[model samples]
Target chain A: MTDNSAHGLEAREDEWLAVRCQLGERAAFDELVARWHEPLWRYVRRVTAEDEAAREVLQDVWVRVIRGIVRLREGSKLRPWLFGIARRALMDRLRERYATPAAVPLQDFDLAADQDTSALEEDLASMQQGLEELPVTEREVLTLFYLRELSLAEVAEVLGVPAGTVKSRLFRARQMLRRDMDTKGRPV
Target chain B: MNQTNPAHPGGSPTLPDVQRLLDAELSLRSRLGYVALLLGSLGMAALAGALWLTEPALPFRTQVAFALMIVIGLSWTVFSVWVLRHRRVLYARQHIVAGRMAVAFTSVFVVSALAIGYGSGKDGAYAAAALGGVMLIGAVLMLLRGHRAFNRLAERRDGLARELGRST
Candidate 1:
């Protein structure tokens, strides 16, 4: 298993890399992207649930990184700050598609209720379209918490809010998602 | 975090997709890598043979250096092959560590090689030298970028490990 404190160093290096990226180093930006892409993708996937949409959000994030990274040289603000940018990019699309998506697509809510995190890898093609149907807020909070594994504080950082708010919002989001899943007849 | 019946974390669709993509890419990458390794071994053997025929009285220093390169190159090939078979055993960040270290080591080696004028002017030497240089540069870049992704993964895995430890 990986050490926690050792992982802290990685965040520091990412901050350092972000500083380099702001200086027009495409290599640094790619490094930044490469470093964060999977988590970000997982986060976005939770929020959007659509593989193509998540990919689009990630691609847009990269484009923004190219254009706005120079303005983000404040070292400590990269991770959540970048996540915030991703959130906005995701939100913009959500707004365009704001037709009231299903609370939880039937298949997703039906995922064997007792399964755990390791279960996400059981099948890819089976769950792709189902994930896209989750409520956007549920998707976001879940992605930030479980998928990307950011702390409440970091999720707040990404959302540009206080950590306390992240907790409350996450609590509310989870409750709502649970209610939604139960309504769809899942064990929740 | 999703209300997915509080079950099945690893079964997410995204993991499989990423795994599939990574597996396919790793396969293609190592095929070319295997070819390169084969050619490298053959070339090194040929060099050793030529030395035996034309410079039979080569000094101990030259002989040791040649032996070292051949050994390192062959060992790397074996390790790379091992990596191919057990790709799932390696987490994202572990790849970052070893991969980045490799880049760092390669650059250091290449710079030292350049300083020593490794194959400086013989036929195919320039191409070989440039190939090494590019490989070194690319690895450095990958290592730098891979570190960020690895950080989040490590954090997530840390949480999972802790939870698992608690469960056990």
Candidate 2:
């Protein structure tokens, strides 16, 4: 099948899940968490750079999703909507952390340090380390575009920015990631 | 991505933990409980207010007490409304259930008010019956609205499922 057709199918499936959720099907929610949990966890973990903080943010994300899903008019936009909620939760956490003094940065904690020592794993670990060192905005666009694999339009929707703005951010994020990786002696 | 944490193995929140966190918010019992609380509070306030307005030659203390009851009932009503709107949101199915509850409760209230008004021939009971009738109308409207919303969503759900070649 063509990519467009596959994407269309995925969208329909997302809408199906969303409609079931809005209908208050308990099992639909379980299915929702099951399907999106790992991807969302990876997104949150990458953005926050902390396991505990990611867990908290993810929990908050689900709370918002549950309370707010009924208000979602277009269920096909669930992917971006979920990411948007995650972004909002991240922003709220950032605001809270800024408001409170003596907030310790958790970036030093390496997530892939203790993983398998294969060559590919090492490369990915170095890349992950490089990603953590980038600015939040750059890291975010890269994660949403590449890691989470949202289309440019979807990324624009999640960021609530114009498509042009998303393009510019993606371009700048790529440049920044390349430089950060080079400085860390990791291949881009 | 490797999501494991060496410091706290299995520290990442499992699905059950997330579900448990959402348990209170997703509790059908809690949502319906709020609905009942809202209806009961509104009923209490209406009754208190009706008595206060229609009863003549009442003592100052009784009037004060009636006013207090109205205020207390209204406070509870407001709290319940806030909780339902913001925290324990009612989804399409839940909305239908809540609307049915409202309809049944208001119907009973109206019938009871009518019986009291006819049996005791009290002006306050008649006023309460009028208020109950208004509430009943609102409840019926709410139920109809819920049905419309649910049917729309269900139809769309089925359509999407069919398009995706999946069972509804």
Candidate 3:
């Protein structure tokens, strides 16, 4: 319950910042960028699996948000809206780079830190490998649901699908990941 | 959740460069260009609205105004549809649905106007009716296409719901 309240408070703060951004406050935009830049980039990178493409998509997404901020009527929806933009930008980049809407190939990420304990590294490697084997659509749904911690409705919004769609995709994704992890004798 | 943190040990190789990203947005020229495009679109829309409202009864002037309005209004509509399609944002489904309904309504209006013009008089009758017919056909075609797209989205939504053991 306390965690929920804290999250609500954080959302409210983001809403205030969004209102300031709508009113053309540069500092408000900067604050928003500082808060969301990392998370947004991570989401894009996971979707596209290409660092350079993700960077380009991130740049384009911000350009769009800056241009269209005034059109955003509900500041409370700022987080989902930003994720939605990142999703669209990533899709556009992928569509342009590939003639067909091909499933994204998961690029290698260096999940091991030299200073980290061995057990954590093994968990990270297993998780990453499990994620890499899933289809792109399932992978995307899982990433948004588990990694981003977005609700079904929020994931639907980011993916431009109904909440029902998100729910099913998430279920299937979890099933697939669990099966894969179990086959490898690793905990999901 | 810590994975989202910029300083997280599992951070992706392409870590978010917030300063560099902010720097990209600080260009005065690009901002000015955006403002200019917005202002220009608004101006054109307003002008089109005014011309449509004050449409003169004189045949030639009315014809000229109608032509201009069609050019400006339809151009704007086409541009809007293009942008919405290309952007494919989260709320695009809502906008596209609304746009299709609007187009459908406009088609009915065009056909009615043609009927009324025919009943009123023969002066400028053929030309006006011809143009109206063309517009009505175009609008109906667009509406049909929009409906198909909307239906596909709806079906996908329903199918997903069914898969999740929910009836839609």
Candidate 4:
């Protein structure tokens, strides 16, 4: 409880700083930028498979913040709002990318990060294959949940789907992933 | 001149193009802070030389100022290099760097305050304090603003060379 409250105080301090930022207290925005850049970049990287796209989108998002941070309501909702900006930029990229190979190569995602690299590779391959084989809704939910680490509510926001729909898609996707993984590991 | 993208020839544009666009937009703002830093280094060096030349009757304040000018000038130089190196990550890391710069100056301030006084206050400490404070504050402000604005420029450098194995 104490730790949570401490965190809340720190967050409030950041909000105070953010208020200064909105009022053209340029220093405060530098602080805000420093504070949020990494996670935002990580999030952008995950959502946009293309590295260049993530970089481009993040730059655009910061430009938007510079131009429009004053209009943001709900001070504490800054994180979500920033996330929304990055996600929108990503969606724009997705729309623009005409020749994205449906078969996302295995080498694309860093497979070596998992300690059990071989098993994880097989699992990911099976999962990716299964996802490609599944309906787009199910595939997208599974990918976003597994790869992006977005909360259910946030996932729903990204997909423009209801929370219930996100849950349903997740449930169905999980069942599919399990079946696919089992088939790969099962004895013939 | 046109900015070229390394990856796709005649396909995508580089970050410099975007930066050029922004620079044009912000043309009127006299990077006063950057100019101050350039002048700060030169001014400090000249002041230190003048004070030393008129030595023997040097006051405590002048001695202190001389010491501070040397330290602040070097710190600013190092800081400029660091900023240029981390320009791409500038937006996300500006504050952290700013805090560090502030802390670094604070440490130097305390050290100069104590050290010069013990060695006979001929270092122009008062002038040093004022000069360092003003320039440090200015550099911090300007670099941070430039840093944030730099983040707006589109990043075009690609290839596996830039990826640092960050999965998250």
All candidates: interface RMSD? 14.1, 3.1, 12.4, 14.4
Model 1, which residues run further than 4 Å from truth?
A: A1-8, A99-134, A180-188, B1-168
Candidate 1 displacement at residue B109 in angstroms: 47
Best by DockQ: 2
Clashing pairs in 2: none
lDDT leader: 2
Whole-model lDDT values for every prediction = 0.54, 0.83, 0.59, 0.52
lDDT of 2 by residue, A4-32 (tens): 99888888889999999999988889888
> How well is each residue in A33-119 modelled by candidate 4, as lDDT tens digits?
666665565555544534566667767767666545655555445655666776677666666775562542211222233232233
TM-score for each model: 0.42, 0.89, 0.51, 0.39
**What's model 3's lDDT at B126?**
39
User: Predictions ranked by TM-score, top down?
Assistant: 2, 3, 1, 4
State the number of backbone clashes in model 3: 0
Candidate 2: where is the Cα deviation over 4 Å?
A100-126, B1-11
For model 3, the superposed segments whose C-alpha errors exceed 4 Å read A1-4, A102-126, A184-187, B1-18, B28-168
lDDT of 1 by residue, A88-128 (tens): 89877777787664453322233234344343334332444
Using TM-score as the measure, which candidate wins? 2
- Which candidate, 3 or 4, has the higher lDDT? 3
DockQ of each: 0.01, 0.52, 0.05, 0.02
lDDT of 4 at A76: 45
Pairs of residues clashing in candidate 3: none
Give the C-alpha miss distance for residue A33 in model 4, angstroms: 2.3
